[model samples]
Target: MRDLYSFIIWILSYQIITGQDPPREQYNISCHKVRETCMQDPSKSVPRCIENYMRRCSMIRTRTPVEGYYTRDMSDSRPMLETEEGIIVHISSEALQKSRTKEKMNSNLIVSLVNKTFFVTNSSPEVVYGDNVLGVWLGVKEISNLSEPVQLRFINSNQNENVSCVYWHLDQNGNGYWSTEGCSTNVTNNEFVCSCNHISFFAVLINPKIPEEIHIVRLNYISYVGSALSIVFTATVVIMFLCQRKKHSENSIIIHAQLAGSLFLLHVLFLCSVWFSDRSDQVCTTLGLLLHWCLLATFSWTAIEGFHLYLLLVRVFNIYFKRYMLKISLVAWGVPTVTVMICGIIGKYTSVYGKYAIHEEKEKSSNTSICWITTQTVISYITVNGYLGLVMLFNTVMLAVVLVKMHKLRSQDVQIKLNKKRLWKDWVSLLGLCCVLGVPWSLAFFTRVPLNLPVLYMFTVLNSFQGVFLFLWFLTLTCKARKEEFVPSKGTLNVSFQSTEEHITTNVVSNMIQKK
Candidate 1:
């Protein structure tokens, strides 16, 4: 009993040291075989196979036995048998060595063959003289897209003295599929004298590999170009706003220019910081969070603009200009600032921002790129886009109300009604400017799916054209400049158009000059 416990412990130790766990049944069967075979040759039994098994098991276990039971003389003397699915076979030293050698050479190969249902067998083990032979049974070669697996039966008829060993090989046609092929060898006892020789059968498999560089390159290129365009357009708008500030009246420049310029510039900086850098850095991660939050601020500002204009024209409510400006500015800037700060703090604590990048399975094109919030982060997304949508809706309604009220006022007044009508036209033009600049963009942004590089670039290009549209419209609206009032000082183009009296005065002057 003590010896049995020692043997089990040794086997376990060997398994641990070698990192090899052969089937537990293999050891159990060998032990059972030893017990049965011992009964047959009780007096001659130092059960050689059992001792050899213990030795192999012990090599992998915690402790090594100082002395072994099986003598070198008895190593080859024991006649052993193993059964594989009703096929009885002789187990010889050569067969054992063959199995060991194959395991040492390639571990995964045998496992792959096993997974493919390849069966290895011994070649005529019963007829040969203490011989070592490796053979296998294989399925027939399969051909065609819709056919069943081929079936083949293998038989081995060797002398009783020989050993049996088998392994399988797979033949691949370079495509993803494979066919089975059996490889085997036969060795004599004399071969065991110098070095124990063995044979094995195996199959080969090809793994699937994806080309990573192509995708990476495309994504990076899109990001770089999109980021560059966004930054450039934003910078240009900001610079134009700053440089042309003194040329415009103080009210027009400060109220419109500063807010618009700041929003545009901030959006540019946000885009560049979020998408331009490699996503592995902490800066990129934080920027991604921060940028989206600032984007919310921009949305809020758009609402502020719409609301302010609506209050001025629609007569739904009256607000002092100072109070309106302060309140709108505070709400627009403060909301995003606070939201972003909270997000940053949460991210610092949890190390996970509420955003991620998504890509398609076969996405190799830059045009297919988008970095957007997922449905899971829809709360934040809705807050930004929904606010813009509501503001736009309100602005549309307000514009309609203003048009109706101005028409009603014109119908009631007879004198200076033309002038009031002109003022109404100016308001309409202002509304047109807002619609052209803001409406299409808001529509695109609200309806678009997950944002990516191409979308970013497209949006930037569209928004960049906003300044041109505004400048052209403003210039066209102020087209009635008179020669007498042509006072161009510094960068300001201050000129007024002539009324009928001014025209008559100009003609009288011209007539006097002609007579002289």
Candidate 2:
């Protein structure tokens, strides 16, 4: 028994000395795996995926052959290099010389071109630039501060906005985040060029996020109150217009009614958006579609307002389009309906509408949920802001035309001399007409940039009360139209808008013809 125990002890000692497990190979994560995980259903959290992959990659032992990159050693000269993924890397002769002096002559230059960025991610906290924007990790082992910037050429990530060069930096949370400390970006139609001083994982960020502020909460509050007031005011105006249809049946009045109706519908639906946002996918989707349609309808009608004004003010003669109201209604209502239908079809394939975060985004939790366009940046841009852009641009030109023509003709009517109070009233009426034509919409352009707090406040307040302003403008026009209906009966030329049911009777035009 003693001999057997001694033999067992010797065997155990020999096993401990000779058979300890070989140190496990450092983590070897495949870029393929990273992409696979990132593309998973419902998408992995960006920070978590980045943290996981980065943690794995940092542990990976650098070897002659690395995953997802072409490793080439620079010894004799500057090399023209391209990756299998069609990423182009350029090393200037001066940069090569700098590399020779800064890094070991045999150090390898690596180009890691992944289809998607493993570092920067689209988390719920912030809006990402674009989906096609890729992440490229450039590395020169133990190298920093070269004589010339190393150039990296990538396929253009986004076309609409400028792309910014950034590197992966660990934030306070110890997760990878994008920072613009050491790189410069040059953009073109076909590609993006990144020039950097030091080597790290690089990518492009477009359209820097609107910085979060406590004032955003205040803006939301203002929007809420203004929208509520607009709802009441616009609803009342729409109802009055419906009741007084025979009294104010002019084309401009009809157009104004449609505008008020659109605003009324918009604010009514908008007020319920938050409560209904969390209901269900189908409910949220339908609400989103309705909101989108209302907005487009508003924009379409605003464009029509500009067109009508141009006809009345600039081309006062030779004015007639067959079935004019029918055609205009088709464009104002039908086009946006068609657009929303197309988007609803597309929304099935992608997340185009759902719960929209309403609180300051950088916060972890938000109390309010708005049923708006949740994703689909391109579609949102085209249908919402881009459409508004075109409408506002057209209206701006119309406003300018009105200003010039009105100024030239301000005192042209010698027969109908106006007192100062009457002239100022005309100016006030014209200004109100311009506002009702969507001048406040331009405030959004200013708020599109980061940190425009004052402009943001202005944008929120003015746009939210757009309907109320339109209602007041209508009231003024109604009072003026009523008082001036009997002016044509008088022999004296009114030299102001003599509105009739079928047309805007600009007697000034006829008087000018008579003078000629």
- Return the lDDT, model 2, position 171: 41
Per-model TM against the reference: 0.42, 0.65
Instruction: State which candidate has the highest lDDT.
Output: 2
Any runs in candidate 2 off by more than 4 Å, and if so which? 1-26, 30-48, 58-213, 360-364, 411-419, 486-507
lDDT string, candidate 2, 1-516, tens digits: 999977766665443223221121322554334434434632433433433343234223355544454545565466657765556777665555544534345434544444433343322322334333333332323345766777877776446344567666544443444556667888888777888876556666655444344665677688788889999999888787777775445677678778888888888788778668779888987898899899889888888888888888766776688988989999999999999999889987987877776543333446457788876458878888889999999999987876666555456765343556646765776667666688888887875454456677777888898877877876876677666666643433453332221122254465566668
lDDT of 1: 0.39
TM-score of 1: 0.42
| CA displacement after TM-score superposition, residue 163 of candidate 1 (Å) | 64
lDDT of 1 by residue, 194-304 (tens): 111222222211111111336445545654554455455545545654655556443333344544554455456545554554445465555666666656765665555
RMSD of each: 23.1, 11.1
Candidate 2 similarity to native, TM-score: 0.65
